[model samples]
Target: MRDSKLIYYRSGCHSANFTTWLIMDVIVQDVNPAISDLPCYWNRETSKSVGLQSTRKLSCLWNGVDVYLPFNFIKNYFEIFGAFSLNHGVKEFDVSHSNSRVLTPSSRYNPREEFMHFASFDVEGRSRVLCVSAGEGVPLSTQWNPQGYFYPTQIAQFALAHYSVHSQAQHRENIKRYTIQLEQEDTAARVRDEDTNSLVIQFKNTLEFALSSPHLVLSLDLKINSDIKTWFKVQLLAEEEGELFTLLYTQSGIYIQSDGSEFQFGFGNKASGRWLRLTRDLFTDLKKGLTHSNDKKKAKKLKRTKLKVISLKFYGSGNVANISLSDGEDLRMFLDGANWFLENQDENGGWPSNVIFNQGQKKYPKAAEIQPGWYGAMCQGQAISVLSRAYHVTRDQKYLTAAEAALGPFQKPVAEGGVKTVFLDRYDWYEEYPTNPSTFILNGFMYSLIGLYDLQNISPDNVIVQLLFKRGMRSLLALLPFYDAGSATFYDLRHFTMQTAPKIARWDYHTTHINQLLLLATIQNSTVLSETAERWRGYMVGKRAPHN
Candidate 1:
């Protein structure tokens, strides 16, 4: 009992036995009905109304080491308690910036918004990954990030989101400051602060504000007084009919009418007599609204043109305030996450995911399941890609140095607390979730490879990165066939997990896999990759390939 790792069900001091010599102690906290008599784990200041003066805390002795479970520690289904450095036995590298080279921009691999959609939560200077929960209004939570832990996959994706926004050219040289310019001082158009001061621009008949230039993002506070039969329209580029984009608020709901097409927002009286703050990417919304355009010439022109919000024509009375414009705030947010990676990296040159990933239990056996305090290839790759781009833009040597140190885990095997492993004793597979039997997740592996490629592009003369990229590419090409499941593709090679049923990719993941392959094909010219991507794309429309 003293030698084995202790497991707690999280409701009480009920312990489950597990045999392992590793440093991690896995606490499997399954969801069950709450017991009224048991101690609650909430903070004393907040949960005291329920006759609870203090939060629950547990202490135990495991393997001759004293273990303390902190207050309100059960944020997720699974939790780990241990030293992160104990898992990785590998020695740390001597980081140097003298050998660092200037990063070269490559059009071959760019961060895609579709795949990298994780939200960033900034607590202090650190960036934590936001995961979806069942809570209403606050559907997303920082999970366990308050305890100095983070999810690598989410951090990587968040970084990629920034990389995508930062790579683009800025719309203008200086930030465009917007102000309310009233055409008249009459009740029909008035700019005055109300009691709340949030709704400052009030109008009944009509109002217009002309922009000196076009902008990408628009932020404002809006209040709807009553639902009117006539539309209260806010138009952009009203002079040009072909490029006209309008936001129509009517009895039904708020709708974005753009380029002869329209789409409605959420259904409700959400903005009725209540101030609703909105921040929108006008350019992206305009593009989505034009998805069904039949005219190629008009669509091309709309895509090329910089959209401008010039006039607001209100048929019904309403209030608007705090109008502002920007190129994009993504650069700031991305840099926040990037700096987090640089600061939070462990001595082993890897970012350890403090959250336990228990999703593999459906397909993988107990032995092949992921452990807590795990490091991922996808996370490392994504972080490297982000840092490389950071160096490219700012020419900061710290980013380059951190990126080089991040390659430490790739050199070691999964058994030695790294993300590298061999599949079928031939191809080198960078495991997204490094398990006993490697789960070679297609999208994750590709993301890791993209990172290596980015690092290699920056440091072309570095033989280590060159070999890693080349070897990973070779493995990717050879293992592409195993992932193809005739009609569709599998998410990972989990068929090796006690011969479980093949885990077919979902619609979204399947699309991401196809896109990743297409991106890889741009880097390495392989007919197999191109053909597979096109064939898998056909699967989306219910096209099937002939079987022998």
Candidate 2:
């Protein structure tokens, strides 16, 4: 038998109940010639060939010539060469005596699509055979088997190469199937599945891009699926060397990270039935690893990590119908919002006191009766600060003009447009809205001062605005002595006549107040204000020395 071929032989036992016979054929060559010398055996009572132990070499007369056959080959023909055949090219092999059928070797396998072929044979004695081919152009099977010894490293290398090729092909197909358009930026890919009505917009190399360009915006357009309020699951998928990271967006603007960590933000409120715009500065924060961990050094290292965005999936009962990609709004969103405030400003150069929600009338009957146009000092001050920022960013004269106009209210008395005040000789400062009998809200006063200061920074030539800002700062400093000296933190609201009120203080108000004081210190170059800011900072961070 040739090394690449196989053969089998069998005969039935001469028993009345067992009349069936089985035979198999195999041919093997290029093997050790010593295999021909083993013994063979037969079972006389059963009339079946069994062992290969005989010293005699069986002679077969073929075309009048005697042929010597190996006893080992005859005895264990199936085991040794069966494995050899399997290793060579066969994908499958089976043997049967009663149900054997012949299969012709034709082009049963298409070369373009099919990667394998199979064949079956039925010889005499009701024997059936099966063989498989690994298809055209495939390398001669080098698979290791017990019958044949081969280099394990060689086999492993071949298997790995095959797998790598297969994996690359699969990756290409996946990209083709999911990709809808590669836009001009080349950084983003828009993918849509029409059948599922789903869309995925992916930003390629998200971590790298975000780290270098922290100002870049990431935006998504969410078209509501229904009128009934529901929370749609928004998912961000990212991968690095096959390691996956996921972030889930929940209704309350909470982001649940892949490692079970969570962070919250107010990017936008989730609502139904209208096209909602979602924007986040958190992507840059995420790339920096600031949201994932508290260690600044580790977070900074993570900024350089290579991570690719796999997809962004918005899933609800209804699938994401469409997705579009853009470079995002960044600070421009703030600019636009400030412009909205500018557009909605009252003719008297102020924004409405508060936004009224008629929908709240369902729960509160007088919700609709709430007045809509009574502007407060805090509101006008903040509006001035926003306009100043807008003007700084865009260099738009319109923002500056609007800001100057908004300052009109603070120039006059409360009976007019300005906030009412009373001068305190002890503090050498003016108290705001002195006509009111209630406690003085620190946020309302401090925030208004911040806005005025910010506006003054931009309009240094305006003497009236500068004077008003200095007066407000003096009042703020005078009020500072009433706060606890040890903490350098004030109560939520302070009494006008009385020296003390509730000791309650919120971190939000504390931080905002400290920041405003720092801004004032920077603008005025005042050592006193700077020292005060440093003291408050030390207090907030628990690093302050024992108060003297």
Model 2 per-residue lDDT tens digits across residues 402-476: 878877667655545455353443322222322232235565676567667667778878786788777777777
What's the lDDT of the predicted structure labeled candidate 2?
0.42
Give me the candidate number with maximum TM-score.
Answer: 1
Candidate 2 regions exceeding 4 Å error are: 1-328, 355-372, 414-420, 423-435, 485-488, 497-500, 534-548
Worst 10 residues of 2 by lDDT: 129-138
For candidate 1, the 10 contiguous residues with the lowest summed lDDT are: 132-141
Number of the top candidate by lDDT? 1
Please give, for residues 120-215, the per-residue lDDT of candidate 1 as tens digits.
222211223222110100111245433223466665665566556454455224445564445566745445556584327676755556554466
> What is each predicted model's overall lDDT from 0 to 1?
0.59, 0.42
| Alpha-carbon shift of residue 516 in model 1 (angstroms) | 1.0
